[model samples]
Target: MGGKTVASLRNRADLLKFDYTHLYGKGHRRPVIAAVTDERLRELVLQSRSWNHLAQGLGYAASNTKDTGWRPRVEARINALGLSTEHFQGRGFNGLAPLAHEPVFTADPTPERLRVAATGKAIAWFSERGYTVSLPVEPAVYDLIVDSPNGLDRIQVKSSAAADRGVHCSRTLYDTTRPGSASTGRYTRRPYEPGEIDYFFIVMADGGMYLLPYEVIGRSMKITVGARYEQFRV
Candidate 1:
């Protein structure tokens, strides 16, 4: 969002730009919100074009600051994630779906059900710290592989949902069908660099979980619920 672009709903101060969406703690330049992560806002709410331009094209607002009730807490988090801001009218991907004028369908909990609730809260947070974790029916890079009592490593289960105080996740996605691109699939939030894994059992949005490690994560991190990393609480 360095280009600083946000144009569309221009009125009540652009509906006060989603009450400064939330999430801050590392380099505070201001950009309401882009992705704190509920699977990168469900892959940018299915490539938003409506939903009033998905929080300013996933960069929230670019200044001129405004925050008032944040549209009933982001429509109570899009009706508690059941979603429906009522926009579309159809025209073959005109803003990309969501306007059939019906509930459509939902039971919530997707993205592999919050990635199996962040791999069952990081395997009950390392079996309550006593350690002895193992779950790899098919993990190749890293998901969970601890045999620690002080040994084996590799653990990466990050999760995110809360956005007002911080917690929106996204490793990648925004292919846009590639081939000459521009169709817009947008959603490139990042983090996790060093060798890709050594420990990072996040999972926030209130159910709280930490356990970070891997050089205190520095790929432009912003996570901040109980800052100080709460001694890597589980």
Candidate 2:
């Protein structure tokens, strides 16, 4: 009584007055705050379809100008947590989809889409086989670098749907100053040289896969996957 003043007594009374849950014998209320752990952030990233989707999950309004810095902050946090932001960027989420169970294409996809799909399949294939796969930070001749028990192998992936009873793989890189015109504009096709890449990972329309050495495939402009290459099927 000597130590407790009027203010203290009033505060205690207020606390008791608000403690109806305890008096009613109802259980304690659930925690209002949840810790944002690295695992939770990674789960959100995986579930997010795009950057804006991720930002919204983190409590930032999509159209709010004040939230403009959220992306950089989130990227920094992801890096601090030892996570890669690649999954939050282009075509990364596509790899997370059920590519194996996807329906057959009714029409041909754009070259870029096809490339992304093929790369996703290649990544899954290597990952399932217990090999460590990584992408180049900068543009390189090879699409993937695979760390195998034998050694590191540079893999260039090529994909083609079955056409006229065969899978056609382009073995050359082309550049055109003017697209859609063969005449009056510079058009060049450069074939893959020896020692450029160790292997060619070919994905066919029917889900058939093959890994062939560059030496065996040579400088051919187009290599058709047929009965002869069946030995290389993986």
Candidate 3:
């Protein structure tokens, strides 16, 4: 495929995957959910309370067939076809509901999952306001590149679910794993430099979002998203 086509396909896949998790909740069932295309089959899968129940309804032999086997095959088929599962719910094939003001996050999610949830919310937030959002093909300083009316803006997403007095957003990147980085094995804190990112999109513990320009909060190692920052809240 051409470069633009590949990127377009990737962007669509990412959006669909995010929508699915946002609607159905994240779990291993994604492939199976995406693979089953028939409305009747989808209804059966969603309405049925359990996987075993779904298997039985599909006419798999309860004695001979392992319920676990079916899901992988369905996922494999979808992968082979290069198609995402269509969301069958009333919302649409994407299964997206109106974006909630605050996205729901799981209890005590790991740092990586938290980052992903925040980024997903950021993408939806910008997209809802009529901007085109794209993810970088390789790792970069910014999390998302948004094509807005003004121009393309690079967005760095930060999230904090832990709060004492306020949500704490770290402005520096840490690389503790690098060998000989420091005596404490911690890399020096490096704040984002000028022109590195156009904006900082923060997701707070309460699900409050803030989109602030880089110039407004420059070179701070840590920013507390509290009352003082209320004006930037989105």
Candidate 4:
């Protein structure tokens, strides 16, 4: 392989064998390695140059280290942006940007868990009100399970700053029927049935909160472009 070809293979190897148990702790041994598309990865590679400039205002570093306390907070912020960070492992360059080692945050461990925890907190927040929530006996790994005296509420929690962008929606609205991008679609699509859940509670990463009507989220998906901050209008 030529120099560039060899380097590309090395980067791919590093991505597959990237280790993070040292920083995130033993609890993060098995992380989900999301298969991003070549286009997306290329876009990220290009954006990595500007990420440092963007991340600084967001309180993130351009590199990963044991010292940066920003990992947890950055993870939380990404969750608010509607991107699945449940699989974030850490943040650092994958060696594919303008700089030999630009900063790229790993999400296999950071973003996804925060979303689950936030959702759980939102659900528990409602359960504490003496509702009839059951914690979802089916165990769909949802954020919250709230059984109100009047009805039931299945909630997914999210946290985001004023800068993150992108929002996903589906037509069926059922967990099994959610739409996905065929170009880079690697996750299991789900159906988003509105009748199944009474409400979608979106807790903002910036301490703002909203009750998204099921109908609104189930009808369509939205992507934020050329912007930094956005709120889900339900």
Best by TM-score: 3
Structural similarity to truth (TM-score) of each candidate: 0.21, 0.47, 0.48, 0.35
lDDT of 1 by residue, 22-76 (tens): 4442254233343345666666666665544564444545241134234455556
- Model 2: per-residue Cα lDDT over 154-214, one tens digit each: 9999887647435334443445654755654445556777888988998876778899988
Worst 10-residue stretch by lDDT in candidate 2?
24-33
Local error of candidate 1 at residue 145 (angstroms): 12
Candidate 2 local Cα displacement, residue 3, angstroms = 36
Q: Per-residue alpha-carbon lDDT of model 4 for 1-234, expressed as tens digits?
A: 376875686587689996422222222212211232334433433344333333332322335333444445544544454444333234553323344675687555444355455566565656677665555566452445666555656664444333653444332222334466644443453545656555566554444455565665553444232222234432
Q: Model 4 segments beyond 4 Å from truth?
A: 1-113, 141-143, 158-166, 169-191, 223-234
Question: In model 3, what are the clashing residue pairs, if there are any?
Answer: 34-85
> How high is the lDDT of residue 214 in model 3?
89
2 against 4, candidate with superior lDDT: 2
Flag the better candidate by TM-score, 1 or 2. Answer: 2
Q: What are the per-residue Cα lDDT tens digits for candidate 3 across 114-224? A: 656999999999889989999999989899999987799999998876655343434545577777746556655677889889999998756689999988777676777
Number of colliding residue pairs in model 3:
1
lDDT of 1 at 162: 52
Q: Which pairs of residues collide in candidate 2? A: none
lDDT of each: 0.60, 0.68, 0.67, 0.46
TM-score, cand. 2: 0.47
Q: What's the candidate order when arranged by decreasing TM-score?
A: 3, 2, 4, 1
* Least well predicted 10-residue stretch by lDDT in candidate 1: 1-10
